[model samples]
Target: MNEVEGRGLCLHNNSNGNLITPSSDDDLRNVFHQIRTTKNPAVINYGASWCRVCSQILPSFCQLSNKFPQLSFIYADIDEWPESTQHIRYTPTFHFYRDGERVDEMLGAGEERLRDCLWLHS
Candidate 1:
């Protein structure tokens, strides 16, 4: 199987509260636009499967996704999207997007900090 398949990072049907991956910059932009059009903010977790910090934050990330269905929860793998890497630094970066524009970003995997940021954004 491919590395993407092994990491479970490949695209799958996105139901409510599902994680979606956008391959290219255009695709990522489209996803951001779609989410912004809904008027609710989006929380994008740019993570890598091999990163231990990312793995630890998955449960909280998953819970946040369910808690805020109005907000789009996107899981973007750094390794998968090289184009976006330049914009963001660090392994697990949290970006809040609204109106197709980035409103705020919180880097790293501290649960409390993430929660606080999400609360502030939403």
Candidate 2:
């Protein structure tokens, strides 16, 4: 079984679903930069507190992260970090980055898409 599967993460539309009050502009940049430093692929879930899909699927995302320690997982609150990801057109967006560069992306918090994203990168 794949690592994600081993952790009980289903890569299907099972739907899912951070608060950082950035003290200053530098704090926001630093957080972004820190996540970008991972040599392995990084997964960021851009979600909102009120999003139902996010609520459903977030546990799976965290399980996948735990199953694969080689990758970094970051969660962003849309309300808190508008400037950090303003270019995004959708909520509950999943992004995969490698060495500070985005290598893959998925839209929505559906299980199928998330499975595809993690499988594609994994």
Candidate 3:
């Protein structure tokens, strides 16, 4: 089972869905910078809270963080960070970054598919 710990914006991975939420555009930029400079594998989930699909898959996205402890998990709500997320055209879009570059993207909500993708990258 997945247990989320803490709330609000977090820069480092912890118990809260193992997710790092950016509080501002600068923080969001920091996330990207850290991922690139550190060469850490990261999964960024771009979604809006109002979207049903996004809401449904969000918990799973957080839960999966526990399963893939090797990868960094980030949750970016488009509405909350519009300027940085304007490129997101779909709800619940998952972007995978590996070796400092965005390597793949998964659009939509599919638990199995997401799990498989995380496994591949993990």
Candidate 4:
């Protein structure tokens, strides 16, 4: 998988949170592994490039990364991970992970709602 900052899903301690984009299934697994090992809270946005709602919330998602440096923000295109993301039933689905376990999930989009979710998770 092609990563902007390579290993650890770019979720390592940093001044600003990173929005990781995994290129392959292996990359996604590696990312999760890092999250699990580090026990860092993470948010994965499962969306499709062609989905209008996905496009709308993505920019806000990126901006939130800057606001919540403590959280790992990841963007996963459902199409790119067809096999790995088969359970995803909605565009712009968000999965929240903490202590290597998935704790919550949200589907659909709204900037304010997303910001609130991030705040709660962060």
C-alpha positional error of residue 87 in candidate 4 after TM-score superposition, expressed in Å: 1.0
Q: List model 3 lDDT by residue over 18-67, tens digit each.
A: 56777777888899999999988999998776788877787787778878
Question: Candidate 1 residues 1-122, lDDT tens each?
Answer: 12343575433334464555676767777776687676668888988888888878866776666655667777777777767656766879998977667899888998888888877777
Tens digits of per-residue lDDT, candidate 2, 1-120, equal 122213332233221212122333366567668756745566778766667787577777766665556666666656656687677677778888777778877887777677667777
Q: Any idea what lDDT model 4 has?
A: 0.80
Arranged by lDDT with the best first, the candidates are 3, 4, 1, 2
Error of 1 at 91 (Å): 1.3
Candidate 1 segments whose C-alpha is farther than 4 A from its true place: 1-5, 8-15, 23-26, 35-39
Tens-digit lDDT string for candidate 4 (7-96) = 222232334636678879889888889888998999999887678888778777877888888899888887888877899999989999
Model 2 TM-score relative to the real fold: 0.69
Please list the residue runs of candidate 4 whose C-alpha ends up more than 4 Å from where it truly belongs after superposition: 1-17
TM-score of each: 0.76, 0.69, 0.86, 0.85
Q: CA lDDT of 30 in candidate 2?
A: 73
Model 2 alpha-carbon miss at residue 45, Å: 0.4
Q: Is candidate 1 or candidate 2 better by TM-score?
A: 1
Q: Please state the error at residue 24 of candidate 1 in Å.
A: 5.1
**Candidate 3 regions off by >4 Å?**
1-17
